[model samples]
Target: MSARRQRWEIRPPAPADVRERLGLPPLLATLLYQRGLLDPAAASAFLAADYATGLHDPFHMRGMAEAAARIAAAIDRGELMAVYGDFDVDGVTAVALLTQAIGAMGGRIRPYIPHRAREGYGLNNVAIGQLAADGVRLLITVDCGISNYAEVVEANRLGIDVIVTDHHHPPAELPPALAVVNPKQPDCAYPFKGLVGVGIAFKLIQALARYGKRPANLRGRDMLDLVALGTVADMGPLLDENRVLVRAGLIALNETARPGVRALMAAAGLAPGLIDSGAIAFALAPRLNAAGRLADARRAYELLLAGDRETADGLAAELNATNRERQALTRQLQARAEELVAQSGRAEQPLIVLASPEFNAGVIGLVAARIAETYHRPVVVIEQGGETSRGSARSIPGFSIIDIFDQCADLFVRYGGHAAAAGFTIATAQIPALEQRLLTLSRQYLRDDQLAPRLMIDAVLPLTELSWELYAGIQQLEPFGQGNPQPILMAPNVTAIDPQPTSDGAHLRMRVRAGNSVFEAIGFHFGRLAEALQRYPTIDLAYQLAVDEWNGQRRMRLLVRDFRRAGGARNGG
Candidate 1:
């Protein structure tokens, strides 16, 4: 089936005042202005998320001091503490970071991560009773427990003080825990609210460090590698405090990662000394997440904090094998989901609800994301079981999946997540009715244009802006994510001077000329554009500025993201 193509109207930014503010070249200034940073100070601050400048005082959070004090008291009294976490990469890393910190501080700590298939997500009464029975005096939750009001109450009844360090959105009724240190909490006073679950745990470590409570021997930077892995894997916004943590953490990962991370990197065929965000996102995160997806998350946590190199290597190999299995399962599930969409005769529906009794609950999120991307609509993938059917939902811009579930709260037995992604459970009988109701809700809320995907351009620049200086200047806006994104520049009326298809026939390598400048560009997975290239040499290209190193030489290249015919009525001036 041929997918519908949507044309986007691109407009170049006004370049008059931005040139004078940063004393930058016109192209760099125009790119900066297009990115919503007009002032030099703001541009500099945005680009430089140094550890010294970007980190905020952890105590600024509403309950950080109380949580820290309670943890400290627990250590001093020799009380047993349990770290409760979920069964995902973020949750596992949060548990691992806290476990390492607490152990280093000479505290008795145990980690509890529920099995995805058996125990499900968040705090449960059974787990609470188990912790109490194990003589856990204090329970500090990571990544979860923000909305477990009943579980927290049960823990309190069992004389277990609960401290929640989570990043999930808080519910209307807050859990009455000993101290809730979540940036997403409605009453939180923290400056930056984009911290991930592990990021929040790192903040607790930061708070402990302030009082000389952290281990004297352990360095703060050592744990940053974990922070980067979890922060990026969780898809937390790389802005504010998260930007700082990820920036420093990437450096730590590249230079001096822990033995476990090093071993995993080797197993994944990645060079240990040059890891970047892409490597972590595509290579490392999935392997660590695979354990939780297919098995127990505790295995991942153990791999990260393993003491012996041999064990770490063995665990890394196992994780690699599991990741391969996860990939195959996801592909099968995605294919089935697409088939269901076709059969429904509502493929263009604003929301996709797919259910399969054979679907694995752990990989449903991946399947949902794939469906959402393929159909350009929000998707919810449900895995039917005996008593309840669990589902995971992924959403597009302007549609909050969590809020949509909240609006239909009566239908769900339990649900929680942020705006873009969420998970829930319902009685198996309710699946059809719930799906129909959601489709109706999607029709009511989503407009035709909203359902179409968009490629948002920051600015249109001339070929003169595709210089080394301009590329380096744009790097000032580093560590970009939700609030800040990598700038996309448009170069118009450019003629393809040299075009050739790659050996694999999946990408096209080309050189384009505009005015007196010539630039090299590569369009990955766009070899089909070669047919159109023979008819028209001129094209408008939207791309990100990239620095490419080939054959021991460094040069600037435009990583082409999208393209269209130029110099016609469809092209905007």
Candidate 2:
């Protein structure tokens, strides 16, 4: 089925003098202004995101002093410490970061990652008991444990000290851990609350380093590569301290000499220099996550901690194959989910809830996210077990999945996530009632227009303005991800000279002409638009600037986002 038509909302350009005031090109200034960076100092700081000035003080986060002190004491006393983490990329990277840091500081450390299909997310009593039996006295959790009130109690009962370092939304009642180092905590005064699990872990190490207790070789910046991987993989907003960490981390990532990192990059077909946030998100993160999605995530964690080239290469190859398998399975499940939604005649419903006993529990989140993006609505995919079902949900922009789960708290055994994504567990018998209740709530909260995707265009420029200088200036905004996305520019009255579908009929490629200028453009997944473009060859296109390299020469290209017939009545904007 064709995707829903998108509504365009073009932002007005900033004042002309913004260029003079901000010392940037007019287009760059306009983009920055639209992002609320109007002051010159702020714009300059954003453009030159130096880590030294950008990263927040580690001690500013509430509970940092206590967490650091406890960790230092444990190191001094030579207590056996265990780093417990989730199964996803964020959790695994956090585990690697903390374990490496602690080991470097002369502490005996072990990493414990729960299996996604078996033990599930967060801290568990069985694992705690096993660790305690192994003589572990200090347990540090990464990317999880915020909502594990009962598990925290279990750890305490086992005589294990727990320090929770997570970025997930905290519950009304906090856990009874020794220290909770989360910026989202109510009493926390941390300036940036958008740190991912690894970012929080980095801050903890930073605090330890400041106290002169960290390993001599393990500086805060040395782990920025891990920080960038986990933060970008988890979709943390690239603003404030997150921006600083990611920007610096990208540099570290490109220059990293770690055997595992180099091997993974080679497998992902990425070059060694000038890696960006997009590369990590699209190439590296998925391969790392493939292990957790299909099997044990410990392989991935060990790969990042691999000390030998042969070991790293073998792990990277395994993960690459797993990622390929994962992609195939995800596509199969997504097609099945679409058919189910269509068969149920719930096409117009605000929320899409799907479930099957055949569904793989590990891949439900990926399928839910894909369906939500395609339908432009909130989606929930559940994997039915014997008596209970596990569910993963993805939400649209305005709807908060976590907030919605909060409203229906009684429906699930346990639930936790961010604004746009979440997971839960409930009895299989409650599926029908949960679906109906969710539909009712969605109907009340969502508007008709909210169901359609909305494209926010930053500026409307003519083809004549597409100069190399403009593109170079825009490149200053590196490491774009959540909260700071690549700018989308609109060009109107571009005549479609010729449009043809790819050989596989999965995409549309064409040459567009504006006056005397011609530009090549590709519309991914827009093969269905070939016939329409033939009917009306003139279009107003929204796209992001891209460069195609051929024979070591760079040529401009347009990555088509959306388009409409030329001279049509402007809608939404």
Best by lDDT: 2
Model 1 C-alpha RMSD vs. true structure (Å) is: 2.9
- Per-residue lDDT tens digits of candidate 2, residues 146-224? 9999999999998999999888989998899999989999989998999989999999988998777777676677788
Q: Scored by CA lDDT, what does every candidate get?
A: 0.84, 0.89
Error (Å) of candidate 2 at residue 429 is 1.5
**TM-score per model over all chains:** 0.91, 0.97
Tens-digit lDDT string for candidate 1 (1-573): 011144455546646767787777665666667767789897677667779877899999989999999999999899999999988889998999999898899999999999998899999999999999999999999999987999999999999999998888788888999999988788778988889899999999989877668875678898899999999888888777888899999888887646788899999888765676667887999999999999878889989998888999999999999999999999898888888889986586778888889789989999999888777899999998777999999999888888778778788888899988999889998998899889888888888988867667677787875666666677766665555667877787888866778887879899888889888889876787776776778887778877656566888878787777775333332
Supply the TM-score for candidate 2.
Answer: 0.97
Position 522, candidate 1: lDDT: 91
